[model samples]
Target chain A: MELSLCNISYSVPGKRILQNINESFKPGRFYGIIGPNGVGKSTLLKLLSGIEKPEQGEARLDGRDISAIPRKELARDVAVLQQGGLAPVGFTVKEIVRMGRFPYQSWLGGESVDPEPLINEALESMGLTGLQHRRLHQLSGGERQRVALAKLMVQQPRILLLDEPTTYLDIGYQLQLLDNVRAWQKSEGLLVIAVLHDLNLAAMYADELIALHEGKVLARGVPDAVLQPDLIETMYETRATIIRHPELDVPQVMLAPGVIKSNGLLSRSLEAHVRRL
Target chain B: MLLLAVSITASLSMGSAGLSFADVWGILLHQLPWMPDADTIWSRGEVAIVMQVRLSRVLLAVLVGACLALAGTGFQGVLRNPLADPYTLGVASGSSVGAAFLILFGFQLAIGVWTIPIVAFLTGIATLLGVIALSRSNGVMQIQTLILSGVILQSFLGAFVSLMVSMSEGVVNQILFWIMGSLAMRGWEHVTMLLPFLLIGLVILIAYSGTMNLFVLGERQAAHLGVRVERTKLIVLVASTLLTAAAVSVSGVIGFVGLVVPHMIRLIVGPDYRYITPLSAIAGGIFLLWADTLARTALSPKELPLGVVTALVGAPFFAYLLHRRMKDQRGEE
Candidate 1:
């Protein structure tokens, strides 16, 4: 399924959060939205996932307006994993994953989607089989993220909207999470969109990148096209150097803190810059 | 199942006017000749009191307890708070004030005995609707705002009830008896009046058990899963409030069963409302039946208030549960 946002605009009472945002997501690809804090990256994802209605815009699943579809039908097509998805107290990892079946189950006298196989598969795919029975509070940060991912995996939605899924993870876990998502996308033909903060990580893993600054799409394309050194510096307001990875040939960024002007005087600030870089 | 059966049998047998298991069975099976018969053997007056009066009281106790517990579980699940009870959201106080007002004033208008309960039910539903309307904004009910509004409404209604009770002349004993709660005058008529409401409430609660599970994950998450969060909440609040109103109108402020039974079930079975709801209903019925039995038998010829018995049992257990939960939180930290 192709997910497209057509001329989307969203605003709160006092401020506009997104303006005429046009984007389309393709299946079997890992897409990333990169931006600073408060840039409405999460809001855009919410619009696409049908969690929040866009103002003066339309999100289409195939050719049909997603907003016109019933919520249950839309829920089957798209799953959103928000950063705030905390398990209630005493909820086991398995129980949390089983909740993914909520959309599939009816109110009364309807059989739940056979959850055992899906739960087992999700736990194994996320490398959380051993921790299935563990309470969510007992898990480490990385383990909890994996449990959250496992829940979304069991949902088996065509489009996955993830907001800062790797915020609390270490570097190793981050890579592992992205790799696991990539593997699932390949096998399941899923459209995966994630909001990420680390530019280098986004460039390395995302098939396509949409960079946002101040609630507007500053740049969007493949990693090489969007992760340019000048674009990074301009968007983030910091000097940066872009280099190709030795093995993968993907663009990698290194900040260049070249100089400092203190009290309108230029000094040899390269040492401090280098340390930070 | 065996435990439930044994509890039912015990409930049938034990009361103020004592009937042995055999006599109770004979009463139940009127055709059985071998069963020890009791026709003026235990005094015709006492037999009528036991078979007609206490049996209905026990049945009503079980029904009210089950209703409260079921409603409590739904309320906690929908609100996503373990501390939430059927009465926590002001429905009880609102119903109390409504019942009290009708009792004190409706006598002058020549309203019958049923006017108080009817007024109480309508007022409870109206208060709940008002709370829901006031707390809702842009199709969202902020949990904290709803809780705060409920607290304020409860205080207001409590004051109203107090004022009515204080100003009433020659009805002090009636008011006190109603407030303290008793199973003394509860008979088949009271049981008949509550049965339909209890059944309706239980059916509604059980029907929404799946949605209640989603509700425990919080509103946004439940809504994202297509659970129609606002409608579900409204249905739950109205239904639970109606259940509580019916129970309170008949029994008059039987506390703690609504608060304690659901929490205990959640602690044992986890937060799956599908299981928690039914288990709470059954366990609640058994608990109140036992409490009523103790109320009658604890002191011969001087029955304790049913509410007092429930508090005596529920308060320490609730404290222990809270302490354990705190310890668990500490351990987690």
Candidate 2:
């Protein structure tokens, strides 16, 4: 594992979000963190990405504590993509992607060699070649997300942290985005940790799936081992049926409504069902 | 740049005394040591008026305009607010308090021409520091906190200014006129005081323009991209505030130029601060030069306030730009 979360815990004022979470992320593998709303999957991603500091423990990159590394040095190796992607800045797609070279560029925005070739490569891979000169606000939802990924690719980071990157996308976009990310992760040998809300998509894309519940890791293993129906039911307190994909051999989650109760009557309030769990 | 030069030349010739453009050019050329002696050709009084008085005032207009506009661009970028201007940090109110204190107390330092502007400069810097100190917690400056502190200080200092205004006997109208903002009778002293700050602030802002591009992603994303968020924010705030304070001290309180000029430039050049900052400086200088000329010539013997001229032109121009942009968006859609 290139990045390790050692006994990480974080809390804000009265609310404890993440508690005693431990995980190791190796290079060349995609890890999906799955949890219900407010379970601190996003918080954990923040810690690992070095955007936030843990309250009780340390996030280590290599053998060094992450906090000890200067921000620019860490930036050269780690990149984070947040939900909603980047705001619609009035910059062209090429200009926005060029900004990812911020860590390597000088004060006057000069690079050693011309960065246009590298930027072009990133744009080509993200399928943004035709949109290079287009302004960010002019792009569609999927296009903007791809532009954001192109920017991250230009940064050339070894570790990628994505926080609900596909939250606002449709099912097709979600799959397309994940497919692109998986391809990039394999090609670059990147350690990709993503906070994914869609369990089916997460199980399909991620090499390992970590199930978090109430600030703790309920299960952590390969998709087939951790994406079980019982684990999903216990963690989320929702009835779910899990079955392996016929070709892919990865478990997929199917919501089985009102199946938790013997009478097959769905509870009107989720809080009541959660209390029962 | 050509427009600015033309405006400056026109302004040099348009005072109460009628000097033609040729006379203005000749008089300006005569002052340069490298040029052939044209001093004897023009009258001494004309030479003095064109070179010393009118030239200084026009240069001061350019300096103050450039500084305010550049500061405005920096503030808008860092705060991520389209409405933010150079004066959003309470520099105007603080300088007003300083000028009011000077006028009411009749405290005349031996600093001669430096008296009012110097006091205002010191007070403006103090106000900025106080706002930053109040807003920053754990060395991180929160945008909302900074704006709130500025508003609070403005109100607080505004009360002091009102008290001083009420207490003053003589110099009341003078203080009021000064506060209204003007570039009248400004000499090389104002230019000297403003130059260093403008140069230094521009250098700092230009150097950081690239990092400013990342700011549109918001603070967290900027940091994730390797910008030392707090450090960059502090430097930009200080540098831009320096530009603002320097302009406010010399010019009293010129509004609208700082707020509208950047937007005007952004409309032409897009929102990249790297291009916006330099272009805003040039356009701002030209804008204020023309406005100042209009202010001086519009009433001939009696000069209108510089601030009024800028607002009159700026408000209508800004409205037109907004309308055009909306139309463009409609077209795009």
Candidate 3:
């Protein structure tokens, strides 16, 4: 089995974050996890990435317990892109990307195989070659996030996990970022499990979608089956309209958002928002 | 290496005795076994001053500076706080209390002059343990909790030291002067005492310098990047704490060098720990060497405190660098 969870359960001091999660993720495919906030999406990612131990069950990769795998070996197999992206430290773009080769380096930072070509290639792919010498603080948030992605690209992990990596990007750049990741996932024959807020993007990119609700897997199937309007509404507790994409064979979601006052006049804020639109 | 050698030679020559560089070099070279003992022209008095007095103190200053800087770099790297230094946890203050307690009770020279330094070193280590014990919870030491715990220990120990200082009216002058810090008359003993810690800490830091770079992203990212975060942090923390304690034991609380030297290195060399770690040690050595030289020779016979010299020179220089960096960032943006 690839990275798989067997009856995983996690809890904080007074709250249960995840409960009885049993899922086996295979390589050579992309999976998207969608849920509302506080539904344990990131927590599950942490468990799979071996950063967090499940309270009840164990996460396993390749038939062995994930936590039992030495960190460097595990890192060589898995790379995680944390939520909010990397912070603005003073490292240059090249330096940050080069760090992705840590698992392959020696105590004195000597790598048996030269990583310069790989780092240079990753930088080129992310459109960061021009800013390779610039410090992280000098880059905008979108550029910083791209730098993080470039770092992971050089890592060449078998499993790439992302948590809201699109938070800082504009729509154009978000599509560009995902397109790069998707291309890499296909070419490298790796697995991509991303916790995504944008249901449409999840539907477009993920081969399979896992919908988490209240710390459990509510649905798991092809996007077409998982993204049904009733299931989306049940998971998010908000009305959503689902339609097949005109250009792609995927379901897209449109928020059907409104609130009614007792007097039945459009709320002052909604009227103002409509007027501005 | 060549610069450190030159700086050490220059410092050895220019004391209140006013010897030249050639005289200093001759005095130093004359002691070499292969060099002709009869070829030495320096007087016994000059030799004594250079070999016994200035050479030892200058080397001590170099060792102390390098230790502080190395320790500071490790602290800043692991804690991911630019403001962290050897003194951040008040180990120096804790050490001072030990030294002061012994001095006030007239037990400083009871077991010879070495007793105070030994006691100070013990207390410094004890304080580190206390900080670690306080900060750690559920086998996890978060950065904020660690820093807060350090601050708590520092203020408490600082108050304890003040109380001791107030109670000892007779030896208060000695305690205060020593606490202000001096590298005076420290012979081979203090140099040898601090040497092993510096060498060991430097070696450990070099091996882990790669992981230190990941620390800038934070502990969580460092773990994800395959660093054994808890193991690395604890080993680095203990090593740096010992380095700081050894330095403090010999030289008292010589502040500012540890706090500013690493930042200066970061500004010049950028944030790669591989470079920052070694560069900080060397730069700290050079900075403290000169500061000590100025401290001894600036006022000549009076010999100003080394701590005052470091703060006076370091603060202004650091302020200038900071101002320039901020302005550069603004201009670039």
DockQ of 3: 0.71
lDDT value for model 1: 0.80
In terms of TM-score, how similar is model 2 to the real structure? 0.94
What ranking emerges by DockQ with the best candidate at the front? 2, 3, 1
lDDT of 2 by residue, B103-195 (tens): 777764547877888889889989999999999886788999999898899899989987877777677877788788998867898898899
Residue-level lDDT for B101 in candidate 3 = 91
lDDT of 2 by residue, A197-238 (tens): 888888889999999997899999998899877787788778
The candidate 2 chain B region of ten consecutive residues with least summed lDDT is B102-111
Residue pairs with backbone atoms closer than 3 Å in model 3 (clashes)? none
- Candidate with more favorable, higher lDDT: 1 or 2: 2
TM-score of chain A of each: 0.89, 0.92, 0.92
Q: Which run of 10 residues does model 1 chain A get worst, by summed lDDT?
A: A263-272
The whole-model C-alpha lDDT of candidate 3 against the native structure comes to: 0.89
**TM-score for the first chain of model 2?**
0.92
From the highest TM-score down, the ranking of the candidates is 3, 2, 1
- Stretches > 4 Å off in candidate 2: A259-277, B108-111, B169-171
